[model samples]
Target chain A: MVSAAGGGRVLADQDVCVGAGQCARVAPGVFDQADDGLVVLLVRDVPAGEVDAVLDAVDRCPSGAVRLGAPAGGPY
Target chain B: MTTTDPGAATAQPGPQDDVPDFPVPRSCPFSPPQTYAGVRERDALTRVRVHGGKHAWLVARFEDVRTALAHPGASSDARNPAFPALGAGEQQVAAELRPFIRMDPPDHTQVRRMLVGEFTLRRVQALRPEIEAVCAEQVEHLLSRPQPADLVADYANRVSTTVICRLLGVPMEDLEFFRRVTSVSGSRTATAQEVGAALQELFGLLDRLIDLKAVTPGDDLVSRLVNGPLARGEITRTSLLSQIGITLNAGHETSRNAIPLAALDLLRHPDQLDLLRADPSLWPDAVDELLRHLSVADVITLRVATQDIALSVGTIPAGDAFIALLAGANHDPAVFDEPERLDVRRAQRHHVAFGHGVHQCVGQNLGRVELEIALRTLLERVPSLRLAVPESELPMRGASAIFGLDEVPVTW
Candidate 1:
């Protein structure tokens, strides 16, 4: 199942999930903790500018649990 | 555990008798006055006469030990002539396991660099929420159980083993198998046959995992290591296997012991538990203090002197073997104030529980995060957690390199 991180942006299991909680700990405004203490995405469509923090979160997942999906309007 | 000196009492004073005089910390088990009377009475670093070999110098001072650990003159290679066990057959085994933590600068640096990316602070912090959730779920289950549960078996060991398994990308179904292997490997008297069997099983498992990642790579560390720069021939398969084995061995056993040991310590001092619960911010510092008070790995990695070196304690001749006692150093009166007293709030920035220098534990940050999550979750979930048996009756010392309870039975 997928969840949102912030700005209503969707995060699938492979995207925005590094298994680390830099998002939950540092950017709690956009992330919430699941019962298992893992960060659950709370926003599904974040703006482009917010991508930096999300990427930082991605950089931190020890297991590399995060991936950024191409935006819909990107060059085919 | 006593041995008489053969040549010391009869012949003229030799190099063995001229042992250095490093002040042994009072925290050493050997330092207790009633435990080993004659040995404790001498200077901390006094040379002990051995029946089979010459007298060997002991480095008891913390700074001296750290220096020895980092010095080029001190070799992790067991082949040195002065190493106490040279007469025995410890060289071959030591040679095999000493690569990352035992070797001198250039070699140690190279091996460590290869694995350093896996343990970066950023990488470790990413596992926080997962680790926290695991701890919370485990503690919740423990809390729901009937009174008088085996905390060590039910909680600590499971939590540690699970985290380590996840980190290594070991199949969930295979965890029990690996846990069994790890438990046997860490036993005090594991026979050669048993160790051989365990290694075979572990290597078999790793081989399968490597193959699985090759075909269907996952986001786990193993897959990254296999398919990333390491896979392009930057690091050898044997080296990766060795690094994986070391990580698993260290990550599992150390955390397994630390969780229960810290639990027992808190249960023994309810006030500290209350203090921690009252203020969750104390969790990080509490973990450090727990590590110091219960310093899990009692003995630091062994170092053999490659050349003669003089220190504040005394002179250590070339090619001698010495053990750095992390437990002793943590409790050294000079380093810690009121060393024996357990203060969860103590500002303990430096503790040798995780050795020092190039060989210092790579996974220590992960370890600290694991401990913090486990302790905080336990406190929040099991408010009344207390020892089921008397403190004295609890088994505190294990037969392995790590010291912890055989089992911690507790009641809410």
Candidate 2:
């Protein structure tokens, strides 16, 4: 779901994830856990309203697996 | 077994024989208190012996324990044959999944360097406002909930888990499962079968995620680690798993124990609680004091002596193992005056709760930020927060290595 706040892409790197379950804690609507418990992104494009929260989650990731793209959508 | 050769130096005297004591059990379980009461009574640096099967040195003195921790011969390798004891077969399985915290020097240094930037004060500070907000939201949630709420399970545990999950880039929906897995891992009672099952399940999950990252690299730490410096034959798959395991293991439990203990201590001492309430600026110092006083991880960091070493208290011969008792050291009179008293204003920068030197908890700064926010927000939002049951009724001490209450029943 690309947010109108200027749709931007959010990439979640699965390799470095130790499954600490943080992104889900911060933005439950956007991040979901698979049956195996690893994180799965619910949405690729983040709305403007949720950008700040998503960015916050990105910054907090210990494994640095989360990245946010520009509204126009390019490589994070 | 056999005493040191007569020509060799005499080992340090252990606990005075006159002191009452109990045998160190065959298994190192976390529940029921381990026999550290005698050790606690001695000076922070007292040399004591614990009889499990053989005599094991117990470093209770603050200074001596610190010295032992930094000593060149203190080995972090679990592979050491002389290593005293571990909880279950899970230790072996867990060993295969070893994290950097369990490794010594060179490897530990390199792995930690990669993570050092992510946990820096600058990064942690950036999350301060968010941490405060999370604390406020949790407090509000608690206030709205039914009374006699278990603070450890509900608030403290949740807060730490949430923060750590965010740091690890895990998805939101998976937080509950991840928390459950980590909780089980933290328990000493967990069977090896349970541990293996959990590990297999976790690894399977990680495998898929790793595959995804390999194909579509993101800007997250995982992607960076996969493609960046670690890609050049420096880091391996097994090594990556180890780091992840360590990060998750340390991320929540330590903070979970510390937060409620600090709360309980402050609540028990209304004077300190009142002072903290009156001056929010004292929150940072208050946290340091609580860490020093509670020292929730009471189990000493394990170390095996590689060579005979002498100290003011006694001598520890090569091959003997010892534990640096943080709780005992924190209360050592030699280090802190009125060691048992909780003084929010006390100068406690030298405390070893996060440890010292190379193995010091890498997440200490992040832990402090989380703690300060939790304490301040809890006090501010739930001014009437107090234990719902008598202190005696509460499960204040952990049955495992990480000490804290099983349930902190509280009412707003």
Best by lDDT: 2
Encode model 2's per-residue lDDT on B170-269: one tens digit a residue: 4445545655676566565677677777766666666566667777886455665666555687888877866766676677778887888788788888
Q: Which interface RMSD values do the candidates have, in the order shown?
A: 11.3, 12.2
Q: Candidates' TM-scores?
A: 0.73, 0.75
lDDT (tens digit, per residue) of candidate 1 on B42-119: 344445432244445555555565666555576665445444432122344335545355456566556655555565
True contacts kept of each: 0.00, 0.00
In the order shown, what is each candidate's alpha-carbon RMSD?
Answer: 12.2, 13.8
- TM-scores for chain B, listed for all candidates: 0.84, 0.87
What lDDT score goes with residue B332 in model 2? 77
Worst 10 residues of 1 chain B by lDDT: B28-37
Which predicted model would earn the best DockQ? 1
Classify candidate 1 by CAPRI docking class.
incorrect
